[model samples]
Target: MTTKEQLTVIRRLMGFAGPYKWFFIWSVVLSATISGINVFLPWLLQTYMDRYLRTSNATIQIMWMFAGFYFGGMLVRAIMQFWQNYSSTMGAEYMLENVRRKLFSQLHAKGMRYFDQTPGGSILSRLMNDTMTFANFWALLNTLILALFAVVSSFIAMYLTDVKVALWTLILVPFLVMTIWYYQHYSSKVYRRMRERLSQLNTKLAEAITGITVIQEFRQEDRTSKRFQKTNQSYYDTRKAMIKTNTLLLSPMINLFYALGTALVLGLFGVRGLHEIVAAGVIYAFITYLNNFYSPMSNMMDSLSDFQNGMVAGSRVLRIVDDQTLAPQQHPVAGATITRGKVEFRHVTFAYDQEHPVLKDVSFVVEPGQTVALVGQTGSGKTSTINVLMRFYEFQSGEVLVDDRDIRDYPAAELRSKLGLVLQEPQLFYGDIQTNIRMYNTAISDEEVRQAARFVQADEFIERLPQGYTTPVLERGTEYSAGERQLITFARTVVTDPKILILDEATANVDTETETMIQTGLNKIQENRTTIAIAHRLSTIQNADQILVLHQGQIVERGTNDELMAQAGYYYDMIQLQNAAHKD
Candidate 1:
């Protein structure tokens, strides 16, 4: 990146400090102050040696006073160091928290197309690992600033003590600067690769874990392990390259410069003769300052590596924040909220990739308090149609009206508040059954929760559990059977009492008796609501007010079940095929 672009990333990362900026500023000030005091200590040592130790009037009391002050100065610096460390750490953590909060909110605000196009593990890597790198960025920045302050202060002290020796010391400064520049150039490229490899590793691991069941069923553990090893090896190689760069440019190189500068100083003293122009005490002080000076410079070089890593990570984070491709969270034009749950799709067309259409001029309508069933072969655009209605993906060249107003007219939150959705796979959080049903909405009373669960027949199995409604659910509600989990999801949707409901039913995962129970619950929830269902079983949607048969991204037939069956068309053939399959 260009210098200006890198500065822009740094300024944006620093902006995340927000209200805690004072903490970070104070920490820098403290570090510089402590370093300033340290520079003064070497000067004090020189003064003590000249005024007391080398003089004929030197006394025991004077030595005691110097010792007391020396130790006392050390004590103060130690206390200041503690405060500096605390403030810097706290500031970095707070800034990290703020960045993560904003990033997460932005992710949630993005349209479904963003999630569809991105991997879950890549997102997690940015959210977790990259954010952590930003935290280290702040810490390293503070250390670098502190080190620079020490280097400058020590240089000034040395120059004031003896200009000739200081000028000789300056000979090696150019080489040190060049070394740092070279390190940054190569380290930035390596760190960027390392971060990419880390993200790939995370993505591969997440996909493998998510599909663990399928892998086990097929006994493909060996193949999966090899796939993971490929990613792991790539990450390991990048890490090794980073380690090699650090070893070459950081401590060892700085120490070499320190040794060169020290040898030059000793050679100057040897030529001048010890007691001549520069005193022995002054030479001792210069040696001490010379060593002290390189300590922070070396530290600064080490921190530059972290700074590079942070900048790369920060750039990734900023890309997500700056992405403007997603539809805005707020509606551009204000209109009435969805009150009646009426929905209409007028010649709607949509494609994930605009080159290939998923829904082609699809037109449909569901009047208020009516249930519309979508029946289609897989990839026939049933789910795409539902996605359009939810405004999860925008449809091209058509108007999707909710409550007789364009979907674009209402704020996403306001429109979605009136709708409920149940996916094919029901997702439950880590909470008790009651909390899952109410979704932790405080406005829902306990009584309302029980009523909703009872309405959906979820209460029958929930009550049978050891703790009933208070029973704790494991991740995704795995402790419960598929039927039981679906029942809980049913209660979750019914509890909202939404004006519009969408169900993508998966009946294959449950037994016949559980399917009947789910159907009864579905009947209760669809009453007096605008319901749209993607039917997996032909029998479940037989009573829908309107049944739309979809084929190849278009509605092939639209009618009530009896009316469609009477025609003996595509709907009839599907029914006959399903019946035959069931009989066999």
Candidate 2:
């Protein structure tokens, strides 16, 4: 990123801290207080040496009083340091939490097309690892505040001791400024590359774990391992570059400046001591003030690496929040709802990528309480039609209507609550049977849960388990068979009592017996609801009220089962192929 872009990203990230500005304000106040204390403690010793010790008037009582004042200043400095650290650290933590939540909500608001084009692992990295850097991001501000206060206060004290020495010490300022500029410009590039490498490493690991079953079955473990090692090595190389950049520019350079500045301050004093009397207290106060001037710079320089890392991470996170590939926009009229669930597509055209259409001028209608099955070969647009009708993707140049009104007129909540969807693979979370069936909808009572389970013919097997409806489910319900998992999903949908039921080739993965059981449940549920079914197996949707045969993103024929068979067109050819496969 360029300097302008980096500043823009930093500004956006700081916006999250607006709600906790008081904490930062207080931290700055405390830092200034501590700097004042630092200046006073050094001068107290100078006062005692010059006024009492040099005149040989030092009594035991005076000695105790000086010691007590020095100790009291140290105590107050410690207290100020505590509050400064606490307020600053907590404020940054709050900002990090808010940023993570906003990112998560933004991910949910993205359209299916966004997920289709992005990797799961890249998204995960930005949401989890990148967001965490923000908590440490504010440490840079605290260090900067301390350095600013310390530099000004210590310089004033030094100037009061000897104006000529103080003026000469500033020769190091221009060189220090040049070093800082070089580090920010170069280290930012290194940190950006480092963040990208970390994201790539996360991507490879997520891909490997998700497909581990396929990999082991195909005996591709060696190949996967080698690829992961290569990505890991790239990440390791970036770390080496980052460490080298920090070592070259941060504490080492700042410490070098401190050493040179100190030599200049003392060398001026030594020349004066030869020609005239230079008070011991004056030399002591001048050296102490010089140390104060340089110490905070070393700390600020040490935090520069975190500054760069946080900027890169913050930019990556904000990119998602600013992405335009959002879920389809809806213009709702109040009181509009999907009551009857009559769905229609009026010459709809749709595409995942705007340039190439996957659905072309598709028109179809399914009346309430009727079942319409979509049949076609792979990529023939059967699923695409369902996706458009379901309003999962924005259809280009078309109007999708439900209940004789534009689909967008209905509130999103109404559409989601009334339309039920069952995907090809059944998904279950880490919950018990009853909870999954109701989908954590607390309003769905135990009686309704059992009724829905029985409605889907899933009650028999579920009741046989020791814990029955309360049985604990593990990751994705791995303990359950595919058929069982799917039946539970069926119960999940049934419990919602949807007006329109959607099935995306629900029986393609089950065995013959489970398919038969699923069909029986499906028949009862389709009694008085509008249904849209996509058929992977030709036989599963043979009894649909109307069948639409599609080819190359267009509907070729539409009729009843026997009506389409008599035409001996795409429908008949598909049937013949399936029948032959069954016999083989």
Candidate 3:
């Protein structure tokens, strides 16, 4: 990212904390108070040395007063520091929480096309590491405030002690400013490179874990390890480059400040013969104050690099939020009872990529309670048809009507609530079997859940498992086989009792026995509902009232099974192929 882009990201991130501006203001106040206490300590030390230690005329009453001031300042400083830490850290956490929430919501609202183009690992890193960088910016802000107080207080104290020495010390300020400016300019580039490499590392690690099964099956573990090593090496190289540059710039800068101060102090005390005139205690105090001044300045400069890194991370997160513009609903559509699941696709045309259309001039109508089956080769637009009907993807130039109303006119939530979908790869989250069944509509009771499971014939296997409906499955239903997961998904769909149902390759991976069981359950669920089945198994959907065969992006054949069989076209050829494979 360029400098302008980074600044924009920082501005956007700061906006999240706009609600907590009061917290930031109080934190800065507390930080400055603590720094002010630090400035008073050197003056108190000088007083203690000159009046109490060097002179025997100092009384016990005066000693106690000095002691009280010394410890009192310490106590007040501690209190201010405590408040500063609490308030600043709280603000950072608050800002991070909101940023994380907004980023997640934005990502969820984005279309499937965005996920197709973005890497999963990169997204994960932005959600995790990027938020951390934003929090670090808060710490840098606190440090800068403290540094400001220290620099101002130290300059006033030094001038009061000795004007000539203060003038000599002030000469190094310009050089110090120039060095920090130069370092910040170059360090930002290094930090940006480091952040990019970190994102790549996250992406590579995610890819390796997600594809571990494929890697092991192909016996390519060594190759995968080698690739990971290359990524890791690149990350290390960038980090090292950043560290090397920082060390070279910062070490010299710190030494230069120290050398300048030491030379000025020595010249004042030795060459000018001022040691007898100036109190030893005052010179010691000046040295301590000078160290205090330079230390925070150096830290502030170093933290500027961290601030740049955080800005880069913030930019990545904001990019997602700004990129996708979600389609808005002006007003909630009045709930219209879908008594009949009549679906009509009127001149619907869609393209996953604009240059290549997936569904071209598609038009179809399904009467209420009718069963329609779509048959097509892979990528022949059967799935795409279902996707558009479900409103998972929008058609570029077409309307999908549900009960004679455009689907777009309905609120997306209400539209989806009326439809049930089961995919080829059924997903079961990490929850009890009962919870999984009722996931689609959680308002349903346990009894209703059981009824749905029984209707889908899932209650049988579920009852056999430990705890029956309460049985907890692992992630992705790892505890159960693929067939079992499909059964659970079917139960979930049945529980919702949607007006329109879509089954996409639902039985493609099951055994004959399970397929028979699924068919029985499907028959029970499909009764009196509008159903669309996309299947390669012609036998399962042979009884469908209508079957549409899609070739490329066009529907080439449409009729009942017997009607299409009589024609002896693409449908006949596919049936023959399946029969031959079965015989073999």
Q: How high is each candidate's TM-score?
A: 0.96, 0.98, 0.94
Which candidate comes out best when scored by TM-score? 2
Task: List candidate 1 stretches off by more than 4 Å.
Answer: 274-277, 325-328, 332-335, 506-508
**Runs in model 3 lying further than 4 Å from the true structure:** 1-3, 48-57, 274-276, 325-332
| Per-residue lDDT of model 3, residues 420-451, tens digit only | 99999888888788888888455899999999
Q: After superposition, how far is residue 308 of candidate 3 from its true place, in Å?
A: 2.3
Measured by lDDT, the strongest candidate is 2
Clash-forming residue pairs, model 2 = none
For all predictions, the C-alpha RMSD in Å is: 1.7, 1.3, 2.3
**Candidate 2, residue 40: how far the Cα is off, in Å:** 1.5
Kindly report which residue pairs in candidate 3 clash with one another. Answer: none
Provide the lowest-lDDT 10-residue window in model 3. Answer: 324-333
lDDT, candidate 1, residue 424? 82
Q: Model 1, 1-584: lDDT tens per residue?
A: 55676799988877788679888889989988998888878877788888777775568898888888888889999999999989999999888888899899989878887887889999999999999998999988889888888888888889998898898899998998889878888888899999999999999999999898999999999999998999999999999999999998999999999999899999998888855776767988899889889989888888888999998999988988987658534464755677899999999899987778889999999999999999989999999988888777777778888887888888777776788988888788998999999888899999999999888788888888898899998888888898888888888888888899998765556678998886777787888899998977888889999999999999999999999999999899999999999999
